[model samples]
Target: MKKVRIFLVLAITSLIAFTSCNQSKPVKTIENLKAGIIGETTASKKYEAFAQKAKEEGHDAIAMLFSAASNAEAVHAANHTKVLESLGEKMDDFTPEFEVKTTAENLQAAIEGESYEVATMYPQFLADAKAEKVQKAEQSFTWALDTEKKHNDFYSNALSALNAESESGLPTGYAVCPVCGNTYDMANVDDKCAFCMTDKSKFINFD
Candidate 1:
């Protein structure tokens, strides 16, 4: 009788542990929802700054497209902010620094930033939406992906035009990786520091 009672106790304890492991956390809380909204808003502001700079530099076409994108981003951010506010959570301000030396540099930075966001950040956002069962979040991410793709194409065309007009008829001051012997094309190259993978500053920049 003693042995049987001990066995029963162990069985109950094991069952409880298994049940706890199988249970999933609650879905679609205000905290996570607010985070998603804030991220999108931050991205919108970054693009807005980039668009303004491009206009200052006379890249009118690129500037116009980016300006349109900024509007779209603002709409997305505001929608999310409204939802979060209804839940009694205040959205944080989002402002990002813009750093591009020239018109070409701005285009390159915009393309690289967009590509990274689409490939890396958007996927994670989609996964979170799926986990939370938030259909709106998924839709928002889809739209962002499409917009980034268009931005990529626009930058590609602009770079080609710039390359064609240079006096030497070639890209200026661009260096090649001695190890990879790859010509630096700012629009497409990985931002990884090729040598040590520490900082992009380590990589040689070709004008």
Candidate 2:
């Protein structure tokens, strides 16, 4: 009887340890998701301010690009929030603080922000989600990471055009996938989003 009790106690202890190990991963993933939410939310608000600045400066085409990218960032924040909720975590309310500057300076700022996400923030979040086996979080991070890279390149090209005073403006239009925030130059849009496979027809177009 004593041996039986000992065996049962050992089994229960092992099960508890296994459950704890599993629980720790989800906690870590939830924290990563929350951080992603903050990053994306800040991007959304900053881009909106940047769009207004561009409009005020008469860079209408660049303003439209910023507007589309702002919407895409909001979509990314929503996706991250959804993942957090799925993990049984509540998302904290966030209000982003940003400075508004000249169109050229704002463009530079946007480029820097996107570069950080591509090179540092999202990469670390992606690794965390992957290690935790949180597929939804991983997907959200991947989508944001890829879109930020594109945003960086777009901002770079726009800055170049602005500096050169080129009559040939940036792309005629921008389209954003509502599902995954994958942005495309309207001139070269695919039938489906390269990242999320969302139908191009469903993309939110900024013209």
Candidate 3:
């Protein structure tokens, strides 16, 4: 009976140690998640403002595209929030700040923002999450990175069209995946997002 009690105590201590280790917060990963949330949230609001400016300029395609990107950013922010929540932390509420310009200028600005995120910000965040073994945070950063690539491409093309005064550069229909924020051209959209496999039915469609 004494031996049995000793063994049980040893097992309990091991369990407690394991639990404490597992519950330890990943500090860098948590900071990355919070920063990602702020960036995405600000991007969302910036796009919204840009969309309104596009509409005012009678640029339907630009307006629709900005709206789609705005929605995608919101989805990305929500995904980051979910990961943070899983870590038993909540983001402090903050307002987004951005300046709205002409459609051409806005497209250029959008391109720059997406380019930085795809090439620098998201890549670093994903790397940190992977290093910390924060699975959910890694997944969120991966999705944002992939989706930002699409946004970058779209914004680049739009800016080029604006520079050339080509109507062909303006897209009329777009869809953003609710699961991963992958952007799709509704012209020949697949049933599922290639990056995240989110169904078209679950996509947020815009025109």
Tens-digit per-residue lDDT, 28-47, candidate 3? 99998999999999999999
Model 2, which residues run further than 4 Å from truth? Answer: 1-22
Candidate with more favorable, higher lDDT: 1 or 2 = 2
Q: What is the C-alpha RMSD of each candidate to the true structure, in Å?
A: 14.0, 2.5, 2.5
lDDT of 2 at 203: 97
lDDT of 3: 0.89
Which ranges in model 1 have alpha carbons more than 4 Å from their true place?
1-39, 86-88, 166-207
Error of 3 at 121 (Å): 0.6
Residue range 48-134, candidate 2, lDDT tens digits: 999999888899889988999999999999999998888778987767888999999999999988988889988888887888899
Model 3 spans > 4 angstroms off = 1-23
The residue-level lDDT of candidate 3 at 132 comes to 89
Query: At residue 179, what lDDT does model 3 achieve?
Result: 87
Task: Give the TM-scores of the predictions, in the order they appear.
Answer: 0.55, 0.90, 0.90
lDDT, model 1: 0.58
